[model samples]
Target chain A: MSENMGNKVSLELYRTQLLARYFEQRASDLFLENLVKGTNHLALGQEAVAAGFGVAMNKSDYTYCTYRGHTHTLVRGAPVAPMLGELMGRECGILGGKGGSMHLTSVEHGAMGSYAIIGAQLCIALGSAWSAQYLGTDQVTTVFFGDGTTNIGTFHEALNMAAVWKLPVVFVCENNLYMEYTPIGKVTAVEHPGADRASAYGLDSIIVDGNDADAVYHAAQDAYARARAGDGPSLIECKTYRHQGHSRADPGKYRPKEEVEAWFARDPISMYRLRMMENGFTDEDLTEMETEIQNTIDEATEVAKLSPVPSLDIIDKDVWADGGSAWRN
Target chain B: MAQLTYREAVAEGIAQEMRRDNNVVFLGEDIAAAGGVFKATVGLFEEFGEKRVIDTPISENAILGAAMGAAMTGLKPIAEIMFSDFLAVCWDMVVNEIAKARYMTNGQVKVPLVIRTANGGGSRFGAQHSQSVENWAMAVPGIKVVAPSNPSDVKGLLAAAIRDPDPVLFFEHKSLYAMKGEVPNGEHVLELGKASVLRQGDDATIVALAAMVPRAVKAAEILATKGIEVTVVDVRSLVPLDTQTILAETVKTGRLFTVEENPRLCGWGSEISSIVTEECFYDLDAPVIRITTPHVPLPSSDNLEDATIPTVERIVETILKNMG
Candidate 1:
């Protein structure tokens, strides 16, 4: 994959990364202003991971993400208005306004879900992969988790099952360096948290410099091809950094200011923009992309605010698929 | 009529379902080639092959989540948890993920899966393996709980459980595996929440669930010899408790006995007692009698463990004492 602006794919890759950045900025501003209710975890520095996976995956492929997953779902093509509506607690949100930010799901786009529990999505992704295998479909499933979730038991269990059954799945650990304020160095024993564990399951691990969208996209594409070929699951540890605190409420005082500044210098969006410029893209072209993304975000916010909250008459709605829930009389 | 053991009945139900629907698959530890610890899933691996009859690693959490995902993606998976005591291993997947997915996602996903586990303690399987956890299933919402008594009920209920478009916990008693009875021919599917009235009488109503149903029927027979005509009602499914059958029977005799294998305090028996009391307290000639296992961990010793569980004599004695 060429990074030069002469390649339309590279331009789109830059567009995706920027789209994530602009969306995060808009979401961050709205959340800080108290317009977006609940605790929304932002993916400011991890834009390449979500966007690159978006670029690499096939339309039929499934993606399961963590709570910091607005970018993941957006990259998977979830409706922007409903995604924003979810943050604003509107009835028209992706999850009917019940799941808030942590549980946005778009089954149509193969964006399975983003569970709040650390390693829970691992099992869910493995299950879907098992389904694809059992039904003899060529679809591949990818699960995104943070470095913190690698410590969870389900991570090992899901990987083991996937290895044993040769399930068509990819375990993508976005090494954001911090597991919810506690730094990875303090808790994890190995330098490569997920890659070290991959050998234990008899699978090879692919370590990628996560800041580069091209690298991640290529790695994920390779994993998809391998999985679709029935070679079993692989672990891709994307070494990335979290720009903001874990959530809106968390402060970044725990990190060394110098380390934070160094990581910010290698920011994925800025790096991609420079590559696009060197490849002969004009400043106006980048500005046009940013303006278009901003309009999209703005319209989503407006549409969400215009939508009414769900009616009280249907308060006990959707509790059961068979309508057997008796929570309300 | 052919006599089918409880295990055979369950296997038959699964086989019939698999034969009927290609999506119905059986998965658990030792269930594939080993054919389940109690042989309940015997010959299924040969019949359905490895694809449907999956042998999984000893990871309940993964299996439960896998079953949920498979169910969501067009497979009706029947996951066996080996023992009901092991339900704790993957409690969150059931209580939080599977049970709450439908409601949390606003009914976007229906958990069309069944968790079948061997329950109860009659063969001295010890504390870890011998728990009757019907209360645990009842405590969680958005999931159905079904415990069948005999071969016929097991066959029907297991069939119904796999086909239901929601999560169902099918508690099969290990003690009743070898217990044989006449099962209906061919395909059998029972309703989810319906209860079967084994016997009818006016003196009193005894509500028994799972393996306790036969014992209650025996106690009722013993009571009849002593000039008592108590009705024996089999409470097949707990979550959708057949309150109509229970209410009608309890209202007829004005006396109800809630019997189960769980411990006495705050168990499913108490839930039934409260349900009857709240619905028709005035109709009761006596306080609802709850004949449950003693509040103690099951002992491995045969005699001691038997003493902890409610016996046929104990049920007869309780019925006689509670007689108005």
Candidate 2:
């Protein structure tokens, strides 16, 4: 396949990537200013990967993601209002005010769910894919994880099952180089975490520029096509970085300023905007898009703040069978 | 009606389900060509082929997780975790994901998955492999826990588990695999959450589960020979425990002795004792007695393991002491 053929990200995809960055930045600001509680793992630099994967899939396809999942949720068309409302702990949240930021789901749009547990979504995603194939549905399940998650045993186990059973799943490894505070090299001896490992299980694996939205999108598209066509599962490792700390609290004192700035130079949102302009987006059009995103963010925040907190009865709810009756019983 | 061993009954139940529904599949470490480590899935691969009976990698988490996924997608998947002890490896999938998916999704999703594993300590397997870990499953919500002590119960309960809309953990005692009993020649589906009275009497009640049911029966016979009547109740399902039957028996007999193979502290026996004490305290002639394994790791030695577990000798003595 040619490098650019069927690999070029469309203008609409570019807007989504830009909006992901803008909304996450706004979320980070609101969080740091004490306007938001709980934790927030901003998908700042990794917007391209989420946008790319979302662009290559239909709404009917399934997606399961990790805690740092704001971009993935948005790209899957989770209304920004519910996303902000979730961060604000409101009744209007996506999970009906049950699951907070990390735990989000929109079953109608085929967003199977996103989990907070590290490497937990891997098995769940594989399960969903098995369900799709068992039910004879064309939908494929894509699970996104960080480079740190590759070190987990569940990741290896999940991949092996997907390969052995030939389940319809696309293992998206967004290698952000850090599993929390520690770097990937300190943990594992192997350099290419995803590239060589998938071969051990006879999986068709590939490495792509995680920052380049189009590359991730095209890789996902090929993998999805294979999965939908019953060619088994594939692992797509996208080398990327996290622009913010692992969580809302960490100031990222572990990283050097020069390294942080070097990564900032490759910010996915800016690159996508530049590409959009080069592809004939006027300055006025870019300005309008930016303003439109800002307005949406503003409206979302306002609406979320007024939304009611989950009812007091919900605290003991959804934890068990029969509406969590067993909890108190 | 043809007689069948507990193992054959379970295997037949799975086969019948697979034949009825194309979406029903079996996945485990050696369930496919190897016919399962215990041969519970023997001849299934020949009948259903690879797509249905799949031998997965040595990953308990993957096996259950894949089953959960398949169940979520509308497939009725029966995943075999070789031993109840190994269920720990996949607890996150079982307890967190499969058990909680229905309620978490606000009833939008249902994980119609069955995780079958062998429990109990009669095989003299070491502590790791011999534990009767039914309490852990009972503690979790949105998941039904069933322990079938006989061949007929195995066939009936397994079919019910497959047909149920929620996730079910089917615990078949490893020692009872070869035990033979009469079963209906045709399909038999037992209702879950209902306990069956194995032997009827009026003097006292013996509530037991899985392997302990047979032990309780022998204890009842000994008590009868001593001029004491004893009722033996097999508390099959643990999660939606048959509290009504237990209460009724306890109220009628005015005496109760619960038996289980697990550790004494907070064991299933302890739960039964508590329930009987709380709901039928006035009806009780004496405090509920519990005959359970000692609060220690299962010893590997034959003599030590025998001493640790609750036997008919111990159950008879406990019932006599409680009745007196």
Write one digit per residue (lDDT tens) for candidate 2, span B281-308: 8998888888889899999999999898
DockQ of every model listed?
Answer: 0.57, 0.44
Quantify all predictions' global Cα lDDT against the true fold.
Answer: 0.88, 0.84
- What TM-score, over all chains together, does every model reach? 0.97, 0.94
Q: Output the lDDT of residue B210, model 2.
A: 93
CA error at residue A178 for candidate 2, angstroms = 0.9
Q: Per-chain TM-score of chain B, candidate 1?
A: 0.98
lDDT of 2 by residue, A62-178 (tens): 898988888898888888888887777788777766666777677777777777767878988888887777778898999999888887888999988888767789999998888
Q: Largest TM-score belongs to which candidate?
A: 1
lDDT minimum window of 10 residues, candidate 1 chain A: A320-329
Candidate 2 ranges with C-alpha deviation above 4 Å: A1-9, A33-35, A313-329
Least accurate 10 contiguous residues by lDDT in model 2 chain A? A1-10
> Once model 1 is optimally superposed onto the true structure by TM-score, how far is the C-alpha of residue B244 displaced, in angstroms?
1.2
